[model samples]
Target: MKYVLFVYGDEKPWADAGAAEREAVYAQWGAYESLLTEHGARRGGNELAASATATTIRKQDGQVLITDGPFAETVEQISGYMVVEAADQAQAVEFAKAQPGEVFLRAVHDYGLDHLAPAEAPPGVRYTLLVYGPGGQETTPEQAAASAQEHYAYIELLLARGAFLDTVALQGLDTAALVRKPGVEVLITHGPFAETVEHLGGYYEIVAKDLDEAIELAKALPEPVVEVRPVVEYSG
Candidate 1:
């Protein structure tokens, strides 16, 4: 089956890591990637920028409302993700747990959701994963940035798999676009989503063995912390 591995966790620590430390940490992932490739397990994936650079887009009343920061507020936001072709949810969870990083495992999921109106989800196959961090667990803010190095490989493994789907990443929250709307009174504000915990960092859409298999695959998803849900099919 295919699974969207929602990879969430602290970024600054890894991103801030020294050259040597960064290289070593990511190097550990090489073995995991090879394991997947050797077994023909991964599909595809991608690395995300910090939430700071992300632009949230919401379709409202025939209009695409673009906003700033993350889609919601949270501390452990999605940093990156991968797509894997696991035999079942168990395998998916295994793959997720194996994701390379330093933060104590945070969260994992299979990934899903019903597409918004006017936006028809692709037909072929795809998985959706929202990455987030565990509250009170992620280390200091600086360390969060340090761990971003593993993102490159985390994404590449899925690309290696055959079920790779669409991927979107954030690059650090942008405060300039903050705005509040009241009828015609749209007030722009400066801030980010949840400053504590529970925010999207990035996501992966993929095809898995089957829904049941997908659930197993999600069980193995990696962390900061996250949840998984199936895409609600709406054929209107």
Candidate 2:
């Protein structure tokens, strides 16, 4: 099974940390990444730029409104994510428990697009389009199928433009789990990290020349609200 670990935490402390402190944090992350690799759980992951650099898009009154900042205004923000291959939800939860801050574990919903090439664009910067929507809504099978078709069409457009990297839809919050390690104890909850009406539905990873191009591409997505954030690049 594939699971996504959404790492959420306050960015202020990190932003305020000095170089040494930041490096220490990075070292901790390095250790965690190594642990995942040793366990054969790490598929792929990336740390995102600060939420302040995010650009959001939403359609209102028939006009697409482009705004600054993240989609959610909360104390804790999503800092990064990891896609892990695990045996089951239990193993995924165990993986999440070792992560820093609070992690939302969500099972990946197969949309039958796994065979698509991750990317076709030339080497350049990458961005993640965080898709948010009103959760806990009921939909008939026909309606769900129609919605999937629309997304598939949009994805095809992305592929033709050589912008598609990867995409994943998440199962509903009912199957979601929150893993937190405040101190010595690990706390696990069987729901979303937040109680907001707009829950994170999924995300698209894409490559673009720059932020402007990324925003332009994000405007083409079918999601009601899309938060575009740059991916932090590290030289290997």
Candidate 3:
């Protein structure tokens, strides 16, 4: 199986750390990347721009409204992602455990574009755009309601274009449980894995002709920090 790892962290800590501390973190990442390569697990990966540069788009009635910042207001944010092939979810979690940040691991499923309408050409492979940002736990009821309405409209647009495969929105990071193994013992921890301003809010898998098309779709999404990754097909 292949898994998409959404990496989240409090960017501030790294940004505010001393030069040596920063270098240490980078070294950790380098080692983790090497591990993936050695295992022939790495497929694709990327680090996103800061949340401050994100643009949130919404189609209301006949107008397309654009917002200047991220959809959710939070401290920790999505900084990067990696796609890797693992034997199963356990191995996937182990891969994430070796990384430097909190990782929301998800299995990838590719639904070919052949079933689309004739106007929508089939793509060579499906792309999984991992949606990462705030969990909206701090938002008021009214604000949450409005955001949901706009998000649904955005989904409708993708569905209409024959690009939608499936989407899953996770609950607040507070509901997360972490599992780990030391030797033969397994350890489980509760609450958000990392204490950051942002959380693994949700994700969407869409079919596209290539990376460019996937990015174009991501750019129009209603969230900040979209990590586009190719879904690896299962040979087993």
Highest lDDT: which candidate? 2
Cα displacement (Å) at residue 62, model 1: 5.7
Tens-digit per-residue lDDT, 1-236, candidate 2:
89999999889999899999988888888888899999989978779999999999998788999999999888799999999999999999988987765799899997677778563545778999999888998989998899898899988888888888889999988879988877788888999978988889999999888999999999988878999999998777
Over 4 Å off, model 2: 119-121
| lDDT measured at residue 120 in model 2 versus the true structure, 0 to 100 | 50
Best by TM-score: 2
Return the candidate ranking by TM-score, descending: 2, 3, 1
Q: What's the lDDT for all of these models?
A: 0.49, 0.89, 0.65
Shift of residue 98 alpha carbon in model 3, Å: 0.9
Poorly placed runs, candidate 3 (over 4 Å):
112-236
Query: What's the TM for model 3?
Result: 0.54
Evaluated against the true structure, the overall lDDT of model 3 is 0.65
For model 1, the stretches where C-alpha displacement exceeds 4 angstroms are 61-63, 102-236
Q: Compared to the true structure, candidate 1 yields what TM-score?
A: 0.45
Instruction: For candidate 1, write residues 150-234 as lDDT tens digits.
Output: 5444445554554455544433333112223335553434333345544455555655555444433333344444333344233
